[model samples]
Target: MASPARPEQNRVVGIALRLCAATCFSFMAASIKLGYRHGVSTPELGFYRFAFGLPPLILWIAWSRNWTAWRTARPLAHVRRAVIGLSTMLMGFSALAYLPLAESTTIGFAAPLFAVALSALVLKEPVGIHRWSAVAIGFAGVLIVMRPAGSQLPALGLALATGAAFGVGIVTITIRQIGRTEGTQTTVLWFTCLSVLALGTLLPVYGRAHDATTWAILFALGTAGGLGQLFLTSSLRYAPVSVVVPFDYFQLLWAVLLGWLIFADHAPATTWAGAAVIIASGLYTLYREHKLGRDRPKADAPL
Candidate 1:
């Protein structure tokens, strides 16, 4: 019999998987932008993301021999999550079409801020002064990044990005409720399968022939998304959320680099400054939640 891995080794493995997941997701976002540039419609991209993503997840289920993950007692809960999750995906992909990747990515950092408020209001979770203060400062950071007055960013993009974040906030709360009775694999598997089914209905309207390059981009987008989901799921298996969640922020850095390299995009000083503030606020919120022994809400990687 093999000895069990030590805690330190497990943590190191978790962090590595977390970082890899971040990279895959970052690359996935870049692919979304690239696919848009290649004349792939937002809805088409959305459909492909879930359709292609489902295969790898199914493979993972088979490999793990976790057939129970496919059997959920909460059908209505899965439907509800799928509805919200699919809408969030379309809004996020549309936002990428309107905003630079880096800016879109920065706006995404606000999801946790929205989650805090949603938890307090919807979940009626206890919110002390510290978490509330963190939420306030985090919104301030979002404002800084938006620079609403004399802002060059597109209004549609800002609205879509912000809406997506808000949707994520609601999803976070919903996940907490479902998570009490459901395993992560069940939640993820049902959401992905349902999303693929729901989005497939739109194909007759938005689907079109694309060049080989565009097809390749779509394929890569779904594959990376599936792989990222796997890595993220596995990371939690190896280490606690507190150990790996912080590395999720590394996706922003990857976004910046990819945006610059591929799109000749340069994020402004305000964007960087705001990202720092938002990240700090988020980190502090996590710290306070852990300190208070509250269940820290998890932010799923963006589609």
Candidate 2:
């Protein structure tokens, strides 16, 4: 029999996988921006993102021999997740189309902050001062990024990105509710399949012919999204949630680099500063959760 890997080896593998997942997601974000620059509509991009992602997930389910994962008692819950999550996806894509890559990305990081408040209010989860403080600090970072009085960021994009974050928060709670009776595979698979169906119906309304280059970009976008989701799911199999999730912030670095190099979009210093604060606060929040015996993954959604 093969020897089992050491705990340290598992941690290293998990961290690497998490970093790869972040890179893939960051690449997907860049692809969305590039697709828009190539004249693709947000709805079309949203449609393809889920449609192409479905195959990989189906293959994964087959490979795992977990066909039972397709069974779910909570069809309505899946519907709610799919509808809300896809709406958030479109909002994020629109934000990418309108805002600098880094800014849109940074705003998305506020999901956990929103989750903190949502947990307290919606879930009736007790929130001590530590997490509440972290949430306050995290929002302060968001405000810094927003720079409400003298902001150069596009107002529409900022609003959309913030809305996406709040949507993510709501989705997080719904996921928690679903988790009470459903497996992760079931939730993810159902969401993707349902989203593909919903977005597919809109294809006639939003789809248009594209040049070969744009078509290639769309394919790349979908591929990156699928690979990112797979990597994120695989990482948790090797390591604890706390150990892997911190690597998610690596997406910010990838976003800054890709934005600057590909789109000539530079993130201002405030973006970096605010991102630092947000990341720090999020880490502290995670640490508090870990210490309190809570082990939920920070970045649960693929996008």
lDDT of 2 at 58: 81
lDDT of 1 by residue, 211-265 (tens): 8888999999999999998888778767877788889899999989999999999
For model 2, which pairs clash?
Answer: none
Q: lDDT (CA) for every model shown?
A: 0.85, 0.87
Positional deviation of 6 in candidate 1, in angstroms?
12
Which residue runs of candidate 2 sit more than 4 Å off their true CA positions?
Answer: 1-9, 297-299
| Model 1 TM | 0.94
Which residue segments of model 1 deviate by more than 4 Å? 1-9, 295-302
Model 2 lDDT on a 0 to 1 scale: 0.87
| The best candidate in terms of lDDT | 2
Clashes (backbone N, CA, C under 3 Å), per candidate, total 0, 0
